[model samples]
Target: MTDHPNSIHQFKVKLINGTEKKLSDYKGKVILIVNTATGCGFAPQLKELETLKNLFKDQDFEVLAFPSNDFGRQEPLNGVDIEEYCAVNHGVSFPMFDKVMVRGSEAHPLYHFLTKISTPRWNFHKYLVNKEGEVEDYFFPFTKPLSSKIKKKIQKLL
Candidate 1:
């Protein structure tokens, strides 16, 4: 496991299926971590994220999605329901976690660590972490996942 305390690899998160995942497991890979809400107006970005995931499947890249109800209660689905909706509707192929508060007192520790770098203003906000498990940069909620800027950063990290 990574020894750096400031690194994202130090954190653990729960999957929708209740499996515990260590961020360290994603070592040496560029990761795009996003807080998503299936009901948000920007829900279309889910499809775009899936497209990006597919585009980089041959490389050491991953898109990890976390469902959040922090904004407008936009993500009403929980657990597997959230997973099914993303798959059936947006064809999301990335790993999705259980619903969690992305901001404020109840925010997950990983989100708190990330907020130390940049905070999510709304659903779909994304953090681009480099292969070393440090937050390289972040995108506003509205930034399309497959935008040239996002893709370029991912390529640069890869």
Candidate 2:
């Protein structure tokens, strides 16, 4: 129970491979946290996200994808299946977490904090976090990962 609004340091989420990773591990990196759905209209953004990762590999930037089934039941795959689909279909190379609800009472703690500060309008919503563990801003589901807005912000943070 932390009082700081942007303090994600205490949160721990599971990787796609079932390993627990503490948010603190990414303490000094700019993190783009996204709630994704495998079967949603915005699913193609996965490739754009990968492009962003490749574009900023030299910088201290990273994208942490969390597969969610909260919107229209779009993400129907389990943890293992989600990983496989992302790898095979999107060629996703960035780290992906286990499928978790991004909305509702059973949402993950990370989502709880994200939605508390800024609500996600739909699947593929992204929350940008600065290196110091502060929420920089929220991007809607339709916002492309490679958009100029995101690119500028990434540049500013890097």
Candidate 3:
């Protein structure tokens, strides 16, 4: 998880509260990174992330939700308001980061590091990063967060 050119651990991200977080801090943890849109139909899936976080809270697993407006102009809310909306509406308790462009030229560097294979086709796209900071798998937007496949992979990663 050192600063290998392709390691996800080398990047840092901004939280919704404007706090800086080093990805290296999560070196030994499995991470589920999801590009979120509050106004998208898949918004309900936020609850599944919360459920997953709670289910594995005692383990070295973390759910990192990133609000993005890249698709359909969704996720109009920003900062703490966006966090609040997701919590109140979808019971999302996982950490949410600042709004970020998850694709295209303006994409966040973390997204760049993650999309070396493929980019998020739409909202709610999920990426599974193993404890070693390597991407183990990717789930498309159509894949439900609570699907057996996702959970099974997560359990395997854990």
Candidate 4:
């Protein structure tokens, strides 16, 4: 539980396509890390996430989705299936990691850090991190991805 900004880099996560990625690769960017679910009430946020990504393409903002079934068994698809569902249904183009548990002892390292710093109340919960990899803010699942609150935060960080 180091408060070091680069501590996130020590964690590696698998991509939906079975590739491994290091958080260090996204060091100099503003990241919105979210725990997602395909059948959740906020599932449509995937589209909003895509919209945000496109709008902030020139800026240092990115959305990293981590599909999870930890809440209500919402997302049951594996990596490959989830990837296809997102791409085909929501036209999601942002990076999506492999399925992960966002809570409890088995949670991924990245999520463990996130929840430890700012606990996510439920699915679709978001952690906004600054360019230096510091946790800046936390948004609940009910908050729309493109809401003014989130948009303003992104603008301020950029």
Candidate 5:
């Protein structure tokens, strides 16, 4: 996928490890961006998200999990602790970014842009971005990462 002169790539985010990265780095990849909460009832979906990452990563798919506490204080872990917990409990291997506000004026810039289309109504809300850096779909909190609908969309994107 060719990079557009101006696109989602212009936004940057901090990684779970405190490093900064521009979304442009993922240019040409199908990105599944999820706002996650470790203590939410939907937390178990993290495991399934990892599965989705493992299954399609080789095909240019990337799962970008952004821990958020904006919803009911569900994700209270600091970056390091969040990383450890996810690795030990769910065996998560996908990129986990630093805790971010998923709504309101303080939200991350990427999220601000995303919310303009469809704000996350709850934890685990997902935004699927195509290789061209355009949002193609929005999956609600209860939508399983591996659900047939999501898989079909992914397959079509691939």
Candidate 6:
């Protein structure tokens, strides 16, 4: 790892299977990190996120999804159930992390870093990180993954 303490790569997160992973492993890649809720109205966005992943997976673009129950108790399932739901319903194939608290005092360190850059008002909020692991942009829960605005940003990063 590098000595850059301000980088997103410095954070660690847990995968859906409970495997701890260093964000440093994704250094130099453009990452779209999103907080998802399987039971939320925006759950359908998972499919579009998967589309983006399939379209840019070979271009150093990665989508990392983290389930969160901090909003309206939208994500009620445990890690395994959440993973299975995404895979079976949305065909999600990107890296999915364990359920995390995206806001409040108990929020994960990674989310703390993310919120410092852009506080999420609700579930399905997204943070677009550049190749340098810096927060480049923030998308509200209502922003569609296929929107020209998001697509253009992803294109520029890729």
Backbone clash count, each prediction separately: 0, 0, 0, 0, 0, 0
lDDT of 5 by residue, 8-108 (tens): 77788899999998898998999999999889999999899999999997899999999999999999898879988988888898999999999999998
Which residue window of length 10 is worst by lDDT in model 6? 1-10
Work out the TM-score per prediction.
0.96, 0.95, 0.95, 0.94, 0.94, 0.95
Scored by CA lDDT, what does every candidate get?
0.93, 0.88, 0.90, 0.88, 0.89, 0.91
Stretches off by above 4 angstroms in model 6 are: 1-4
Q: lDDT score, residue 57, model 4?
A: 89
Report the lDDT tens digits of candidate 1 across residue range 47-148.
999999999999999999999999999998899999999999999989999888889989998898899888899999999999999999999987899899
Pairs in clash, predicted candidate 2: none
User: What digit string (tens of lDDT, one per residue) describes model 6 on residues 29-96?
Assistant: 99899999999999999999999888887899999999999999999999789999999999998999
Model 2 spans with C-alpha error above 4 angstroms: 1-5
| Per-residue lDDT over 59-146 for candidate 4, one digit per residue giving the tens place of the 0 to 100 score | 9889999999999999988878887898899999999999998889998888878787777667899988888888889998889999
- Kindly list the per-residue Cα lDDT of model 2 for residues 1-158, writing each as its tens digit: 47654677778889988999989999989989999989999999999999999899888899999998888999989978897898899989999998888888899888888887788778999988889888888899888999999989888887
Best by lDDT: 1
Residue 157, model 1: lDDT of 90
Q: Tell me the spans in candidate 4 whose CA falls farther than 4 Å from its real position.
A: 1-6
Poorly placed runs, candidate 3 (over 4 Å): 1-4
Candidate 3: tens digits of C-alpha lDDT, residues 22-86: 88889999999999999999998999889988888898999999999999998888899999999
TM-score preference between candidates 2 and 4, better one = 2
Point out the worst 10-residue segment of candidate 3 by lDDT: 1-10
In TM-score terms, candidate 1 sits at 0.96
**Global CA lDDT of candidate 5, please?**
0.89
Pull out the clashing pairs in model 5.
none
